[model samples]
Structures are given as C-alpha cells and as structure tokens.
Target: MKYLFAILHKLRPLFPQSLVNYGYHFPKAYLAARLYGNPGADLEIIGVTGTDGKTTTSTLIYHILKTARKKVALISTVDAKIGRKNLSTGLHVTSPNPFTLQALLRRMRSQKIRYVVLEVTSHGLDQFRIYPLHPVIAVLTNITHEHLDYHRTMGAYMTAKLRLFKSAKHAVVNKDLPLFGEINARLPKVMFSTYSLHESSQLKPDNIKYFQDHTTFTLGNTFYSIPLTGEYNLYNVLAAISTALLLHVHQSDIKRALMSFKGVKGRLESIENKRGLHTYVDFAHTPGALRAVLTNLRSLKKPAEQLIVIFGAALWVVSLVVYGKRLLSNLIVLKLST
Candidate 1:
C-alpha cells in the first residue's frame, strides 16, 4: 500500500486535483481509521489550527494538562510527546499522514492517555487527512494572509479552517482578529469561548508586563509569568490557559506549567552564547509573523546596538516587497542581508 501510494503520488499531477484528493486521500484516511479502530473516538482530543501559534498553544495546553497529573499527549510541528517518549512526526509536517496519525492515537489509547492536543493545518483539514478524528475543543489562533495559492482566495482559505471548528463540540478563538466576527456570526455563541489581548472576552489578560526574557500578565485575578517574550506569545498563553481551564485543570497547576514551560524549538528560541550577545532563531514565515518577532526583539535590544537580520527566500511566491517593507519598518540601527 505504501508503494501504491508512492506511485499515485508520482502520477498525482496527471490526474484532476479533486480526484486525487477526494479519491486517494479520502480512502487512505478511512482505511487507516478502520484499521486502527478509530482510536480518536475514545479519546479527549483538542485540535489547534491557524496560520500561526498552533505549536506553542498546543504544547502549552499539553504541558498544563500533564502538569496537572492528567495523562495527555501532544502532537505539534515541533515533535510528539507520548508518555516519556518524544517522537518525530515528520520533517516540515504539522499533522502527520493518516496512518501515522491513527497509529499514534491507537498507541495513546492503549496507554490510557485521556487528552491529546493535536496541531492541525489548513492543508491537513482540506485534504481529508484527519477525517476520522473529532476534536472536543477546537482552537483558532488567528488567520492572516497565507496559502492563497492553494485555496485561491481568502474566503476559501478561511472556509478550510472553519471545517475543524464545525467538527468540534466547543471552540476557543482569538477575539481580536477580524476573522472572529465572521466566526461569531456563523457558529453558535454557546459553542465559543473567546480570549483576547485588547478587547472584552471570556479570557482577557490584565496588568501585562514585558521583559527581555519573560512576560508577566494577570488572568482571572491570578498573576502569571512565562519564560517567553512577545505580545503575540501572550495570545498563545491565553489560549492554553483557556483550554486548560475548560478541562478542569487547576489555576495553580496552570501557573506552574506556564512558569516551567521553556518554549517550543525554532519559535523564538534563544541560542546560548558566551559572547553576551542576544541571538534567536524563529520559524516566522509570513509578514505578520516576521513583524511580531521583530517587534519583540527591537524592544529588547539597546538603542546603540545594531540589530542584524538574515532571512532567505520563501519556497512559495509571497509578496517579497511587503515582507521587505515590514522588515524595514522595524529596522533602526540594523544590518540586513537576504
């Protein structure tokens, strides 16, 4: 079957795109689920999807649950944690293929893992790859300009993301995004639990403070501090805290988890050096993400220090001019090489 799929992949461009997706990928998902007895049906699943922040939010949710002494597993773009084992899902893949995904779910079920935080992508949702998994909670970080080439329009792209929320029993969404208004109009208010940084929502932070190495905020009258920097990261933390609270995790456990959780790799990851220089590596692909990352770094750097930026070309045809303009707007005393 692996060879058969490989052969079909080689001939995929020859067939109609819909036929290849619905005909080939659909059957693969169904077969994998049937073979694995649809393990997800018996598990408490949280599906996290958006243009960004999925990994951090999912991992944080898993961390809070695990810290609260719950048997939880996490499958993010960074890695998958099943009990004590850390397994690589794949290179450059968010949600694994149907076979690997279902197999992981089966393993989690056998181990009595009650909760699974799975980071899903728009492509994974649209392709019917995760067709058999029904999430109890769906999380949308935010939707911005991305992946328009495949979906052809922003409306189509947004619709693909909505599919996950439609399958979920409850949804946690970012209320600050304009997309939130659309989501609110479509889904029932009872199904939504919102979090926001600048607007009134169910979960809004207060008394926010930003530092070079960490951030402090107040949620639900309890002050929380995280070893992560950036306002965007505040949203990620809020998302996790909201989900953890929904699962009945204690606020004290959530505070401890937020303090201990270092962060995900390549998502504003700091590299230690002996030279007393601040260096970071991040997985910022879009202009909005680039702006957020740079904005945080600029706040941390000294006025006299030169901020150096080095980035490469994107694999897809993004508006390089817009990216460049965003980068330039954040540059003060800076050196840029692309």
Candidate 2:
C-alpha cells in the first residue's frame, strides 16, 4: 500500500491537487475501511483537532469516559489504546495512514469498544484518511499558525482543521479563539457548546489556582482539581469537561475522574533528579504551546531558581526557533543547541 502511495506521488505533476486527493487518497482510505469491515460504523467516535493540545485533550476525554465505565479507546500522537491495553503510536505521524487507522479501529470494534477518542490532524483531514469515521462529537482546541509548510497558508491550514466539523453531529469549541465565531458560522446546524475563562461561555472556570504539583478551579459551584499544571491546561480540562457533560456523564463522575487523573505523558510531564532538580518533558512545538509551558514553569519556580529549557523540532522547526527566541528571551536563561 505504501509503495502504491509512493508511485502515486510521482504522478503529482500530471494531476490537479483535488484530483489526486479525491482519486487516489480518498479511494485508498475507503478501500482500507471496506477491507477492515467498516469498524468505525460500529462505534461512537470523537475527534479532537487543533494547532496544540490535541493529544492532551483527546487523552483527557478518553480518561473521563473510561473512568465513567464506558468501554473507550484512544488514538493520539503519543499512544493508542483498546480497552485497558495500551501501545505506543510507533509512527512519527499524529494520524497514521488509512490502512493502519482502519485496522486499529476494527480491532477496537471487535473488542466492543463503545467510544473512541481520536486526535485528528489537518494532514489526515486533508488526505481523507479519517473518511470512514464520522465523529459524534468533534472538538477544536484552537487554531493558530501551524503546518504552513504543507498547507502553504494559515487560511488553508484552518480550512483543513475545520473539515472535521462538517461531518460531526456536535462540536465543542474554545470560546477564546478568534476562529470560534467562524467555526460556529460554518457549522450552524451542528450543536455547539463552548468553554472559556470568560464569563460569557457555557462552561467557564472560576477560583482558578495553580500550584507546583496541581491546579484547582471551579465549574459552577463544584470545585475540581487536577494534577496537571498551566493555565492552558485548565483550558484543556474545560474542553474535556464540556464534552463529558454533552455526553450526559454525571457531574460527580466528571469530578471523580478529573481528580484521579494524572497528566498526559510528554505534555508538561515532570521529571525529578536525585539532586532535587526538576526537568520537564513536553511535546510543545507551536509558539502558543511553548509559551504556555514556559510561563507555567516560570510561575512554579522559586524566586532564586534558574529554569533551563531544551527543545526539539517537528512540523515547523524554523518558525519554532524564531518564536522560541523571542518568547523565551526574558522568560528563561536562553540556551541554544544544534
């Protein structure tokens, strides 16, 4: 299948982009689904997509549903799961090709998994890799500058992300994003709910507090706390919570799940050394994500402590370098390594 894709790439110059997408990739995805018995049709799928926080948000939604005793599975950039069994993604890509994705979904369907929380990507949406699954709930964490190398412009990138909502029955959105209005306009028929720090949102956090090891906030009159840090993480929590509520999960169950939830790996993950120094492992590649992680770390630092950061690149390395330099100049002791 991969070889076939490679051969198709050679014909890129002879065909238009839409033709290549519809003729080659779309059919490939559909064939993969047919071969896998159309597993996505047997399960309720939820797709989460954004420039940042897709993994964490998807994981959070998975955890919440699992804790509530729903048979749930998750597929994210970092890992994939079926019931209690977990596996590393093994692929560098956030969303794998059609054959791989449909096969995984088929396995989950065989296990009678009721729900799947998937981290959808723009590349996957544009390529029609997720064409077999129409999500019951689609979440947009937020859209920002990302993947411009392939999409070529911010508008195109956003259009790719918005594709998820087109087939979705309901949507959970970040009210704080400028794109929210446009997304709402586009999905006028889709049931929409929003979360934000602002008072006007349907679900807003109150009494927010961030500490070294955990953060606390209130949604309505119920207080909830999570072991994850960062104000941005609070948004992630809100996103998950809103989805749970939309699914009709009990508020008590939501609180219980969140309270017991540990943070996602590689997203603001903390490591401690014997000398009591702390190191963090994070998959924050975008400017907004990098800034959020650093800002959270700064708040957690003692007055005299020094914060050192290490970064690696993924989609937009050059843009990350430029943004990192500008954002971290006064925030951390800057160190660059090639």
Candidate 3:
C-alpha cells in the first residue's frame, strides 16, 4: 500500500483529480482509521479550518479547554500535544496523513483525552486525509486567496472547507467574511455561532484597542485583555471564545486563559531586549496574513524608524506574485530568497 501510494503520488499529475482524491487518498485514510480502531470516534474534536489563523485559533481553544480543566489535546501546524507530551506532526503540514493522524489520536485516547482541537486545511478536507473523524464543533476562521494550485478555483476551495461543517454538530464562523452568507444560506442556521470584528455577529468585540504587547476588547460587559496583539488576532480570540463558550466554559476561566496565554510559537513571537529594539518572528506566508502582520508592526514603529523586512519563500510555496506586490507597496526592505 505504501509503494502504491508512492507510485500514485509520482503519477498524480496524469490522473483525474477526483480519482486521485477519492481513489487514492480516501481509501488510504479509511484503511488507516480502521487499522487504528478509529480512535477519533472516542474523542470530542474541535476542527478549525481556513486559509489563515487556524493554528492561532486552535491553540487558543486548546488553552481555554486546558484552563477549564478539560482533558484536551491539540493538533496544529505548529505541533501536537497529548497530555504532557509534545509531538511534532511534521514540517509545513497543517493536517497530517491518516496514518500519522490516527496514531496521534490513538495516543490521545490512551491518555484518556476527552477533547481535541484539530487544525484542518482545505487540502486535508478535499483529499479526505482526515476521513471519518467528524468534529463535534467546526470553526471557520475565514477564507482567502490560498491553495489555488491544488483547488484550481475558489468555489472548489470553499466546497472543501464546507465539508468540515457538514458533519459537525455545531459551527463557529467568522461572519465578517463574504463567505458567511453562502454558508448561512446552505447550512442550518441553528448550527452556527458567529463572531465578527466588523458588522453585527453573535460574538463581537467592542471598545477594541491594539498595542504592541497586548490587546483589549469587550464582549458584552466582560472585558478581555489578551497578550496577543493585532486586529487580525482579535478575530482569532473571538473564535476561540465562541468555541469555549459552546463547550460551557465559564467567562472567568476564559478570561484567565486568555490573559495567561503567551501566544502561539512562531506566530507574532516577540524577542525581548533592553536595547530599545522591537523584533518579532512570525510564520506569515499568505498574502492576507503578511499584510496583517506588517500592518501591525508598522503601527508600532515610530515615524522616523524604517521597518526592515527580510522576506524568505519556501520552495514548495508559490506566494511570490501577490506577496511581492504587498511588499513593494510597503517600501520596506525586500530581501528575497528561495
């Protein structure tokens, strides 16, 4: 089966996409799940999917659940956590293949974890890499221009994202995006709990303020001041809050979790120094994410200080065209390399 998978991967370009997706990926995932006793079946999973903010949102939800003293695990692009163990899923992989995923779930099951926050990608959903592992709660951060090489069109990409919500008992969505209307129209409205930074939503943050070190926002009468900054992160926080609330976590626990949360690694990570230099390292590869990161950094810089950006591109990722356009407009340092 491994050899056949290798051969199919090599000849993938010649075959029809549907065949590659269903015939190859789906069967492999199905077999792997069966082999592993379908460990995900015993877990209450929270699946977070979108072009960006998936890792941050998933981590936030995991943190909240952990703080609330729920037996929770996490699988994101960053890494996977099972009880006290931290496992590396893979490099540059959002959702692992079925075998790896099933193994992780099995480990989680052994640890008696009751809940899991899994980050889902469009490619993962389309290829059925996480087959038969239905999420109890599905969260859609937002859809944007991403993974066009595999999906070929926005409609197909959206369709892939829609698959996550199909089986979920509840969905927490970002109502600010244009995709919200289509999702609301297609899916049952009662299944949805929404958050928005703009316009009305079930979870909207009022009196929002952004700072270099942290951000403050209000949801109803409760005030939240989180360590993570940027307006983009506010959406992530709200999504996490919505999911936590759905799980029946108290507002006080949520606030405590957010306040103590240091933030996701390699995501707006800050380097502290006494030399009056503000430097951050982030894994913002997408155009939309890049824009948001630079915008946040620019806001923190003084008028006389220049924001130096040393841009690096991964060989497998093709984001240069749109990425370059955004960088050029910023007039910052554009040191490009593959």
Candidate 4:
C-alpha cells in the first residue's frame, strides 16, 4: 500500500485524475472489504457509541484487552491505533469519511490484531461512514442532549446511537440509565447484558479523593486505584471491566489494566499550572457534557482552590465538528481589546 501510494505519487503528473479518484474513494471500502469483508478479517469489532464516555470507555477496553495479551486496535475521537502504531491522519477525533476508517482497518488486519474497538459516532452512522463493518459487541455508554441539530431531536439522536446495538452480536448497556430500555427495545435480535460502575453489592470503590485538576479512587480492595476523578469515569471503568469479564478475562488482569488507564487527551486534560488557577482543556461541547465536567471539577477541587471556567466561547468548536452535529454553534470568544 505504501509502495502503491508512492508509485501513484510518482505517476501523479502523468495521470493526476486517475490517482486522485482512487485516493478519494475505493480504498477504505476496498481495503475494509479486502481485509475484513466477505469473510470479514477474523477480527472482533467492539463498537462503543454514546454522547459521552465513549472515548474513555473505548480506551479502557483497549488497555484491558492489551493487559489480557490480545493484540488490539482502537479508533477513538482522540486517536487511532493498529496494535501500537498511531494512525491519526487528522487532528480532530473523527474520520472525515468512511474510506479513512476502512483504510485503518486494513492496516489493523496486517497487524494480526484479534480485537478492534471502534468509537462509533452518530455522525459517522448518519453519513454512512461506518458501513461494511460489524461490531461483535456493542456498548451503549449513555445518552444526553447532544447532536440535536443533526438529528433534530433527542429521539433522533437516540435512534442514531442505537444503531450500535442494531449492528452488533451482543450489546452492553448501562442498566442504571433510563434510556437503555429504548435502546434495548430496538435491539430485539441482539443479545445484551447490563453492568454498572455505580456501587452495587460489594464492588464499590473503597475510597475517593478529588482535586480540581486530579482525582483518585481506590478500586474496591487492596491498594489499586483508578487514577482519575468523576462519577462518569466510574461508570466508564465499570463498563470496560464488565466487557473484560464478558471476554472471560481474569480479575487480576482487569485490575492491572485499570490502574494504568489514565485518560483520553483533552478530556479534562490539564494544561499545567497557569498562575494559580488550575487550567483544564476538556473536549466537552454539549450542555449535558459541559454541565457534568464543571460539576465534576467542582466536586474534585480542594475547598481552598477556586475554579473559574474560561471557555472563551469555545463550545461550538466541539458541537459542530466533534460530533458532526450543529448544536447551535454559539461561542463567545473572549479577547481583551487593545
């Protein structure tokens, strides 16, 4: 493929249109089909889709699988990896088209990966960019007010995300959430199991400490810990741990993986210390997401430390592009006039 692209690059001057056509199309579809279609590449695809927690949950799944010693590939909003190679052709957490997705899967096939975790988006589904692929297991993390402009309503948004269950062999749902009923209803043919990160029975966290920039939670027993903060992340890890258990992974291995799973980039990513304020750059755009993040930050912060969110009206940057839905792209960029 590199040779093919190189040869095409050499021949671009002679047959620009021919080479352009192939690059623009055919590859993601052709490569996905060639590598995974028909017989479908023998790789397991686990699609994680929801308004939030998809990235964290997807990463958690990948890390747990890696600890279990299975070769894995993942496509999240932040990055794409085939085994260990990062295949981020774009800076944003999305694939502009399906071809890119297919092409990446082709690379994964060559890596001899046994598992593939894809962060599926409603936008990707809406645009038909995720076709020609099947997820053996689908995880519905949660749903909130997001991507309304693209789907036009909460109902439409829910429908778009539910397609994960529609396309998977087994669907994993957060049973604590009310939205799961509708999603489960839509997946009449698909097998599903529920799991919760929320404290149930004897599996709750032993203790938790929250700071403005950092939060740590002790994993039920021993000295192991989940090295981030937020109730949402608790659910994310619970979802990942449940999937790991479903895959028949050992508890020891899952615990080991969870300890190492820090977080995804820009999802409340700390930008070092700016003066005295602990600045954080989060990939939150929607109303629900923003509210959750701010609330989490407040809960995690020390009593003495104050949090003054300086979004600078960057909300629309994520809404319109990240999820590919126009959730009223209204931003208020702050500038001190000279």
1 versus 4: better lDDT goes to? 1
For 107-202, candidate 3 gives per-residue lDDT tens digits of 999989999999999989999988998898999999987767677778888999989998899999999998789888877744999998887878
Stretches of model 3 off by over 4 angstroms after superposition: 314-338
Report the Cα lDDT for candidate 3.
0.88
Total clashes for model 4: 5
Q: Which stretches of candidate 4 lie over 4 Å from their true place?
A: 1-40, 93-96, 197-224, 274-277, 314-338
How much lDDT does each candidate structure score? 0.86, 0.84, 0.88, 0.70
Question: Model 4 scores what on Cα lDDT?
Answer: 0.70
Error of 4 at 214 (Å): 6.6
User: Which pairs clash in the backbone of model 1?
Assistant: none
Q: TM-score each candidate.
A: 0.92, 0.90, 0.92, 0.77
Residue-pair clashes, model 2: 0
Off by over 4 Å in 2: 1-6, 9-16, 313-338
Give one digit per residue, the lDDT tens place, for model 4 in 150-177.
Answer: 5777887887787667768878788777
lDDT for residue 15 in candidate 4, whole number 0-100: 52
Residue 262's C-alpha lDDT in candidate 2?
Answer: 79
lDDT string, candidate 1, 30-139, tens digits: 98999999999999999999998999999999999999999999999988899999999999789799999999999999999999999999889888888878899999
Best by lDDT: 3
Kindly indicate the candidate among 2 and 3 with the higher TM-score. Answer: 3
Question: Least lDDT summed over 10 consecutive residues: which range in candidate 4?
Answer: 329-338
